[model samples]
Target: MKKIKYFYNTNTLRYEKLVTPLRVRLLRVFGFVSALLVSSALVIWVYTRFVPRPTDKVMEYRYNSMKENYATLKSEVKTLQDQIAQLEKRDNEVYRSIFEANPVPDSMRVKLIEKKKELDKVEALNDDQLSNEIANSLNNIAARISYQRTSYDGIEKLINNQEAKLSSIPAIQPLSNKDLTRIASGFGMRIHPIYGIPKMHNGLDFTAPQGTPIYATGDGTVTTAGVGNGTGNHVIINHGYGYETVYMHMVRIKVRDGQHVKRGEVIGWVGSTGASTGPHCHYEVHINGSPVDPVYFFYNDLNAEQYDRLLKLAATGSAKSFD
Candidate 1:
């Protein structure tokens, strides 16, 4: 180290110092480096304490927000599921009522059963299931709705088909409020009174006195009402829905061809003009061009018990002529 002397001039406010050059330069450099280090340390400490870190509070807040969103989505899914169940129940009731009113086709019933099974599967799901489960339930509901729409389409098609077929066939009672005892012969294989051999009897014979009133069986147009030597004053009515009825052995025909007639409307008077044994009305029901027993036509007029009884009787009765 070098010895240094220093002097001060107080009047001029000036200071003077004498030292070795190398030692003074080293001390100055050391002081400058020390001050830089102190400043850097202070900056680092302030940043560490005052500013937010990269992966701490921000990440926690984001996690909580995600959880809240998931909860809200789950609740919405549950509400939608409940609504679907209610709609399915209502649809089932409507389908049941339709079945009670009219016979359900086999194909429609099968689809309904399939929908019910899908609904059952949806109902079995738990709330804790993932989003995929909710999506699956939504898909099933859409499929069921599609199936119901298809079922309605099928029913409409069936109705249209039936109506077309019924336009050609005859199935209705020929008269209303007339004495049922006037039926002298019935349908089935019977011995022809004239031929004395087995013959197919297509209609019932109502033996009424000449000039007894005859009525239409259902709403229809009279297709034909004229003389047929064998049937004797025949009238063919075309009722919609695969139904047609024939009225024969009439004394006077009141309805013309293509004339619309309602059920229970007088269309003629009973008489024996054809190959008749007496003055009677021969009524027949042809369903889709095939003859069914005329007794079945009266089914609509019977109550449930009476209809059942009639069915029982028909099931057990011996084959008899409905000539």
Candidate 2:
């Protein structure tokens, strides 16, 4: 503290104490402040240039971690897209095939593709690829679910149509299976029992005792109920949709012309009437007025194996129609 200042006063006598000027003192203070600031700046520069900081390292690590996660998410999104395609494939192959329905229209699938492309564009705009990829995956899942719901709705409509078609088509035995002892004859060429000549049977014959209840095989209106020259007391049902059924050689007809009958309803009773040699019902299934083998139409009531046996039995049968 004793180090003396040396500013001489002009008006003082020789060897007088020196007083510092206000301007010089102010200049010195300004110089000291400038030096302090410069030194502090230098120290800060050296520390930042030579020493590592946790904040910078953490930022870099977070960036790298996010990149790795984004890669994984990208792979996951691709897998989900592949899975969605597979689901669409199955919807067409299995579900649509059963109902004879066409698959989703190309335009619909194209719209879905376009929407995905738009979503991907949005994903690309994001700086964080992981978030983008996750968003894309969620969008893809939601879109596919929506598409699948629409397809399922269409499939449901097709299923309802198929059910109606099934109901309209013949499905059950014209007579009770318990009362049916055997198929006396099947459609195809066979020697006529009464004529003693080969003729197309054009129907199936189920031999039963007289007065056995004969049931209608499907839902329809009776178109004809009268005696045919050879069909005996027959009833012909006009089931719309190019389908019709005939029951012949009945002792009595319970259904009159224009009467509606459901499947398994008693329409007549079996008898040896007309030119029939025995008591049996001549059952026929006509599709578009063309006769198809009646045994093949019973798949609704029989399994594949049982149907195969029945088919085989009809194939090897050698009996003639009683009518």
Candidate 3:
């Protein structure tokens, strides 16, 4: 059913059946639609402002997880750095110390200062940047580890050579002196038997019968095994490391020049040959061409009491030198 309403029209001065114009109806409908759209927009704005979307929730979770993982990675890197520092310290203080070698240079090690600066700002780094930074750090660590391994190899070689160096030292007597009564003349100023004047006795003289075997005091190559002016038939053994040993007044020269011999090997026999008064073996130790007391080199063959007694005998030996 349709209902119609009448409006009082003052211009017509009477109540009549009201007729609404199409423009007025259209205006009223437009206003109502505009209001409804504004209200809907306001409600949507409020919901979006206060609520989180599914994508936002997922992104937030991922970000938090990334932070936790980055922190763990940083901690692991720090642990590796600490371990490397300890290794460097030990290399300088222990291994290098024992071998008497220099420490590895800083250039051989990782440049941690620059890398540490970048890692300190890990929070500011993106995923790609963080990955690259960690990769660089790991590469540096690997290189440093390789350098340390090479250093250890060098130290091992030095250890091997150390044995040869020990054997090459002159550390024995030139002849058997188990009875501790063989030193005829000690090293110092003594009266020369032939000259009858005071002369520098640079070697120890061991009085023995003719043809008594004389031994080489160390492992070395014989540099001279012939007659010397005042030394008679002597042998000069060139032990390496600034050391040399001489055996003079030999009745028989058993070793020739350029022959390599070991310690305690027979190189000659005792005799009074040149500028000598009696049958004896003259033994000398030279360090860098300077003569030192031969009595000091007999530690390898003598015990405590025997060495002490020998020392006393050499110190208070015959004032006259054999050669």
Candidate 4:
């Protein structure tokens, strides 16, 4: 059923049925729609402000997880950098000393300040940028490790060669003289038996029997195994590293012209050959073609007391040279 509303018509002072204007009805409907829309918008704004969506919660969890992971990764990177720094210090100070090489310069290593500045920008970086930064740091460290390994390889080679050099040096007496009694004439000026004048005796003369064995003083190849006008049946061994040894006035040469011989190997026998006056052996050590005192090279076989006694005997003035 439709209900009609009445209104007072003041002009006629009587009650009449009211007929609302089309404009007023339309305005009333517009007001209701506007109020409803405003209320709905306010409720939606409050709900979104106080409550999170499922996707938003998941995103928040992921972000927090990523931050924790980044912190852990940063700590690990710092530890690796510190370890590498320690390794570099050891490599420079300790390992380089083995081969007498100069240390690897600090300039060749990573620049800490530059790397720190790059890493400091991590807080502002996105996930991808941070990942790239970490990767780059790792690559730099790996490259340094590779370089250090190569340096160690070179040091190893140098050490091996140094060992060989030490082994090749002349370090023993030419003949066995444990009692220190065979030195007949020492180095320096002596009266020549044949010339009857003072002459430079370039080697030590050891008085031994005619068949006494003479030994090589070092590891080397025999370069001379024949006779000389003044040296008799002599043997010259060429030990590398600017060293050579000669055994002169031998009765018989046991080594060939190019035979390789070791220390203490018999290379000849003592004899009074050439200008020699008695059955003795003359031994000399040469460095780069010039003769040095062979007495100094006997360190490997002599102790302190024996060396001192031998030094005294070799320095004693003798009246004549055996050869």
Tens digits of lDDT, candidate 1, 1-323: 96778778787778778455898999999999999999999999998788767876777776686687578767766766776676656556555655755345669888999989867976886544534565566667667766766776676677666665543333344554223334455666767766667888887776667898887767788899899878878789888666788888788899999999877788999888877767778788878888878777764455667655644554443243323
Predictions in order: lDDT? 0.71, 0.82, 0.86, 0.85
Clashing pairs in 3: none
**Clash list (residue pairs), candidate 2:** none
Least accurate 10 contiguous residues by lDDT in model 4: 102-111
Per-residue C-alpha lDDT of model 3 across residues 132-188, encoded as one tens digit per residue: 677676768768776886776677677666767678788888778789888989999
Instruction: Tell me the tens digit of each residue's lDDT in model 2 across 58-142.
Output: 8788889788877877776787778678767867776666868875566788889999997887766756654765667677786
Candidate 3 wrongly placed segments (more than 4 Å): 1-126
Clashing pairs in 4: none
Over the full model, what C-alpha lDDT does candidate 2 score relative to the true structure? Answer: 0.82
Candidate ordering by TM-score (highest first) = 4, 3, 2, 1
TM-score of 1: 0.53
Candidate with more favorable, higher TM-score: 2 or 4:
4
> How does model 4 score by TM-score?
0.64
TM-score for each candidate, following the candidate numbering: 0.53, 0.54, 0.63, 0.64
